[model samples]
Target: MNYTLLNSIIVIYVGLIAYLGYLGYKHTNSTKDYLVAGGEINPFIMALSYGAAFISTSAIIGFGGAAGAFGMGLLWLTFFTIFVGIFIAFVFFGKRTRQMGQNLEATTFPDLLGKRYDSNLIRAFSSLIIFVFMPLYAGAVLIGAARFLETGLGISYITALIVFTAIITVYVTTGGLKGVMYADAFQGSIMFLGMAFLIIYTYVQLGGFTNAHVLLTDMVHLVPAKLQAIGHQGWTSMPKFGSALWWVVISTLVLGVGIGTLAQPQLAVKFMTVKSNKSLNRATLIGGIFIFSMTGVAFVVGALSNAYFFKNFGKTALEMVGGNFDKVIPLFIKTCMPEWFAYIFMLTLIAAAISTLSSLFHVMGASIGKDLYESMITKDNRGSQKQSMFLIRTGIVAGILLSLLLGYILPISIIARATAMFFGIAAATFLPMFMLGIYWKGVTRIGAISGMFTGALSSIFWLVFIHKKEAVALGISQAIFGKPFLIETFPWMVVDPIIVALPLSLAVTIAVSFFTGNTAIQPPHLKKCFEGIG
Candidate 1:
């Protein structure tokens, strides 16, 4: 690959994003505009932005690497992403969210929940959770992109991390959500098109799909002895029932990310950006198609790359990629694709990173500044648009700095797991409250708070104390209370924290709400906001 050409293309792409950020700044006038793009974003841009924010470098790099390690079985995640994350999200959640958001005059996720229930505690606590946990998600995304750069371009990880973070922060702080959305739309298009091409090119390079599968099957007997001994088959074939890999893929990766998308603060907030339910309906088709292509292609290409590497090097692609899992896709791209295509792929990867990072930072900023700060510290200063915008920008900077620091400190091997952990936590904590709050008027403040706290705390406790990595990191024995944390008979994969926590949260929410008295007092502006929108 021509380093000069690759570097030049990246520079041009980033410069263009910077220019777009400047344009977004010009359009940003009030806190509403900064936080929600004036709630007038085009449906196409809104859909693309939603997809871009949802499918980060984590999806392409982190999960794609996961596909390499786990095989095509992880493709179930793509199906769920389209059906659950996109279709259900838009059809079930989007319209109600838009109506409720407008009705409550809410700009951030926390704002919607707090104002919906008329609880300052909800606003402050929700903001606190987002500010604290979102950085871990953001850090994982940073590691995904930086790991690609280190593997693909031979750049230092720290340097790549700094550069990528700096570029995204500059745009996000200046351009706000509208800027982030516009950039995301553009970057998302590149991601979709680039992945489509990469998939096709990979198949062709491997002497077509049939031959590739045949080759992979023939090499089944060559499966690592250790893996085979552990009940692993070939990469082309699915894992055996009760296998460790099988459980991890199905439970943690697929279910974790697939179900988790509904509660993502970054994606959920996007539903509030559109003008109407009709816009959200329209976006559903666009988002579904885009996600299907981007995620589907990544998984297909990742699986097929194994065949290609084995043909050339007499070893699986994972062997050449240094077994880091995160490096698999980058290694595949560098070795298989032409220099020009690799350059474009690099741009696509960067676009994925920056687009998602911008959205994450923007949401984190809004949660901290608009939702928490204005509601708590500056409630009386709501009329001061300039002051609120300044605070939001300051929050963006703080979020970027915190995430960067976390990215620097977190171990690279577990980057993908960390990313999955964030999503799992978000789903467990926010999904029930968000969904029930929109549709069920009986949802009390105590119910919401209990659900949020239980879901969030339980998810974290499982990931930290009960998870295998945490056990190893903390030097604790895996056998606790006879077998793991909660239940002995149930598999760890079956009883993942998200599975446990989400239901528990919902149960607690209903139980507490029924027992406690209602604190419901609809906001004065509710009817005015909901009157015209159907």
Candidate 2:
């Protein structure tokens, strides 16, 4: 509608990002700088980068849409985002991870585990998992941003995806960790401002906060019959406890991403980007505030969007989005917000997508270059440092291509489910090893490997064969089992893989460690992982 002003804002945003990328490229001279910013990142930058990387377009566009469909009950995830994702992650996990990563000279999440246990197989396996599965998560982020451009600005979806991917790949491929984090910090600021204004303005538009929520509560009778059959209650309240929608929202969306955030390889590696514990301690406040505003406002606004749409258009947000939940926020912004605010918020969405995409590509590249290929070459005494960096750069390109392909092919309304799937898989595969490796001296290499394999494999199996999203989408269960899903039981069809996979992984690790008779070889470097221990 207002092309001139929108174009100017975009140009300025792009220029600022390019300048940050230049600074990153200038500072990044060696492999160490490329991979971990030489372990000397500013505390403020690290905190902002961590928060930005963690809450991407997937959270704002994807999960926000989910909130619009499912209701304000999604606020439980906000609580978890603050307490678990920020506070506990920084205080408990971040401190130990940084200390151990520094002690072990580890540059990646998989490298930390492999070095901690002195097992090359563990490192390579975990890295391979990242190289393969991370694209699904990256694709979700790509789709979220791309969909916004397509829906809000009338850009071609293919053009949006390619352009977004191209810009991010350039900065990430050149500037490395420094470039990624610097850009992330700037983008995070934009996102924080955009979401803050969004929530405040939304409330003002729909009367006061209390009146808006009360109106929403009164619209429970307007819910679709199909949704009610599946347990959706009201926009202002939770679904029936233990109902199908309840299980999907709680077990899949909430627990999947909430608890799963602890083991995120991309985010975990951020702990090692800084120099000391004080940086992490300082980060806690920044990270907490960022996550709270980002997620809290998103959920509140998303749920309120339904009310806004219903009142204005006499139709639900879901109906307006044409069954594609991911389009709800973009549609809201395009139709409701002032033209200038719409342009500014467009930059915010782009920032969110680019920040997360940069981190994902970096992690994917390092996993392949430093962990998989480099580990093999070093094991055979044939690895050159230059060759390792080349391999990682190659991996970054490959990862981006795969994600672009997935973004093109994935079905509509898949952003939230796809995001959950990645987080759940990461939690199942890596959480046990990461948590125990940091705190428990008795954790054996064999135990960790077994848990890792079991967790990863079982999660994939369940997703492919049992989870409703994949099964129904692929038509595999319908073909094989004469049903939309393989598991016909209640809650099973709705339950996320993490609920089953994570516990089995934890149990297997503990059992294997106990049965194998605490013959753990605690090397000096490994012992340094735990402070005040022999």
Candidate 3:
């Protein structure tokens, strides 16, 4: 609403980010510095940076918008992230990953996994997956930020998309992970504080916490006939089980992201940035609080935006935004909240977006440069810095352009759905291989490769042929099978790709590993990976 104030804030924030980027550029000497922050970072900064990168605009704008449109059942996602994403990740995965990475002298996630499996093809396959799908995830975040900017600043969506991407292009290219972490710490703080205010103020506006839910519950009769047919319940209650709506919420939204977080390359890579086990333990406490303030608040507020909109303007959130779920949170903030809070919230969104985009692009660059180009293309597995830097920046620029393009063409209310799809894809492609590669010596190169391919191929096959939401949009099944999806049944059509593909990946990996256990790697190498850590 206030361009002059907003523009001023933008300048200051960009100036700080630039300075941090320069600091990172100055500190980044070796490839290790650029990729993993020289293997030492503050626990607080690492935790906050990890949380900030993990949340993104997808959590706030996209998922929050979903909450507003659908209801509060998404709260289960918050619980999952805390338990699985934060706790299981740190206690079970993070400690081992850090030591294994240090032992392998790995620079990126693909490098870590590939070295553990003693297979360059494993690295190439994993890196290819990241390079392919990470941009799509980044695109979802890209569009989420642009949507908010277009709505809050009253600009066209295309203009918002370009301007935001343009700002990110200059700095992320120069700044290494150290700079990214510093900027993330700063941005994550704003997000946490802004969201803290957001939840409190929203509740205060809608008759406190208890009354807010009551207001929403009382309006359950207002559900449209179309929604009720598919199990639309009140905001306070979960959808009726076995319904399409129930499957989407649980299978796609909650489980897809919640489980997928464990195997995310961007998040996994951060664990290696910390030097010791204690740092990760400290990080767990800070990370849990940060995640709650971001996703938990966004979902609760998004669900309750319905109550707010109805009481004030006699329309549901979907009605107010003309059925565009992505615009719900932005529209609500601009219309309902105080002008000053809008400024903070906008900064919060910008921070969340940039914090995430920078990391995603950086990870893309590393995935391509270190994992694919160096390991696969070069015989020595590492070429000159000039060549390496060239490809890394090339990956960054390419990913940025692709994400910007997706931001333009993606359909309305596609943010959260797109995010879940990316997460699920990541889960299917890498989760089984990655998890077993670290934890089990019984895992073989053949098993890891088989699992990765099976999971990735099967997941894509299911998404294109069976998953109702993505299949109908892609329409490949329509042309070949003469149907939008190959399956027209009840729950089978609605079940997530991760549910089926992940289990297949696990079973295939284990079955193959059992047969190939005698062909395992040298004991000394295996000992190196498991040394001095659980």
Candidate 4:
């Protein structure tokens, strides 16, 4: 792996990151500056920062490996990520969130919703949810990067986990959101250039774009027996509808993360950093391009690695990695690309990891330090600035520790699954109320509370007892009922929890809001919420 060259690269990358973090520290002068960059971040930097935070090693390594195994069907996720995650989020959600956040003087996401609904319970509970579960997503990202270092650098996975965690904890804690965004912009640029080069190099290796996919379609028979029974039609074609594979690909991988992007506290908070609706509008194109380059190239290159492996090694990508798809992309790069290119690509993955990890830790810190601590401990929504920063720093450290622990504890091939699990939970718990809170004048405090609890509890219930994948692994249902899942039926067992929980949440929010009426929020406060909307 060329230790001398690798060490040189690490020094350069870490140096750049330190400089950016210092820049972020200098820019942060207050709670607002630390949290949202004082709401004056440039559109280009915001777009890149958001895109970088959104696409981490989880997308490049975990989902990319899934593409190697699942085929081009993952492209649908790329489409949704670009369209719904960026377009709808910015056009429909961003403009309003920025204005409302500016109006309410909200810093954190929990604060944004809590202030909007005028309920401390909403703020506190939302803070707890983000603080608790965001680590799972952070852990998934950590695992992806740790595995890459383990594969590429021959470093121990635990060493990678601890070292990277420490670096990012300091980076985020000292620099705040400004530091995170500045570093993210740098990372995002590397990700773009690396991925752009990868796709071009990949197509040349596998003949041409047309021939590469044709070869994959023809290798349908190469799919294993276990996969064949489950619905392995072909790499190029969709999984057979209603099959287990189809359910997993559609519900968990595609819909779970794709739709879940909207309510992400880390990403949503980025919208509040921009100054105007026009910035959000302009950001859409840049963000779309960034996401497309990151995810699109990843899935495409991953799917094509199978062809390259089969032609030379006479095995599929999954088989080459000994059935651990998490190792697929790293192994492919190590074997196929030039040594110089391989080292460069490793930075791309590292950047993805640092960008997302820093953001996750930042959001987790705010959830606890700013939202939960202020609402629960201080009793005033506004707490001492010095004390709040102290708690936030503590939260970032604790979040990093928990995330690193999970990175070590989780099983292989868990990168994509862990990520989707957090996304699905976040979607079910927050999205219904979030969507209504920002858009609907009639949404009441009680309704928001009811909907939020229902979504959160129901999603947990489904995971613990109903969703076969989670239920079996978690063993909660097995311990209680002597069955892995409550229903072992074909479709029910495979369905993602968000599919059921989100609708129930939305239904309850709407019904409860009408039952409570617009009087739930006082006229003046409600008027303040929608003040500038036409």
Model 4 CA lDDT for position 489: 73
Regarding lDDT, does 1 or 3 come out ahead? 3
Task: Compose the digit string of candidate 3's lDDT tens values, residues 1-534.
Answer: 677887788788778878888888889897788889988999999999999999999999999999886789999999999999999999998998999999999989889988898888989888899988888889999998998889888889889999999999987988789889989999999999999999999999999999999999998987667778899898778989889889999999999999999999999999999999999999999999999889999999999999999999998998998889899999999988998789888989999999999999998888876688766665665668767777888888888888888888889999999889889989988889888877888888888889999999998999999998889999999999889998887888999999999999999999998887884355557888888854
Candidate 3 TM-score, true structure as reference: 0.98
Q: Candidate 3 — which pairs collide?
A: 68-302
Error of 2 at 436 (Å): 0.3
* Number of the candidate with higher TM-score, 1 or 2: 2
Q: Which ten residues in a row have the lowest lDDT in candidate 3?
A: 374-383
Q: Cα lDDT of model 2 overall?
A: 0.90
lDDT of 1 by residue, 254-364 (tens): 888899898888888899899988899889999999999888888777777778888888888668776777888888888898889888988898888888888888888
Full-model lDDT for every candidate: 0.81, 0.90, 0.89, 0.90
Question: What number of clashing residue pairs does each candidate have, in the order they appear?
Answer: 0, 0, 1, 0
Error of 1 at 468 (Å): 2.1
Q: Cα miss at 85, model 2 (Å)?
A: 0.6
Query: Where does candidate 4 clash, by residue pair?
Result: none
Better of 3 and 4 by lDDT: 4
List the candidates' TM-scores in order: 0.93, 0.97, 0.98, 0.98
Better model by lDDT: candidate 2 vs candidate 3? 2
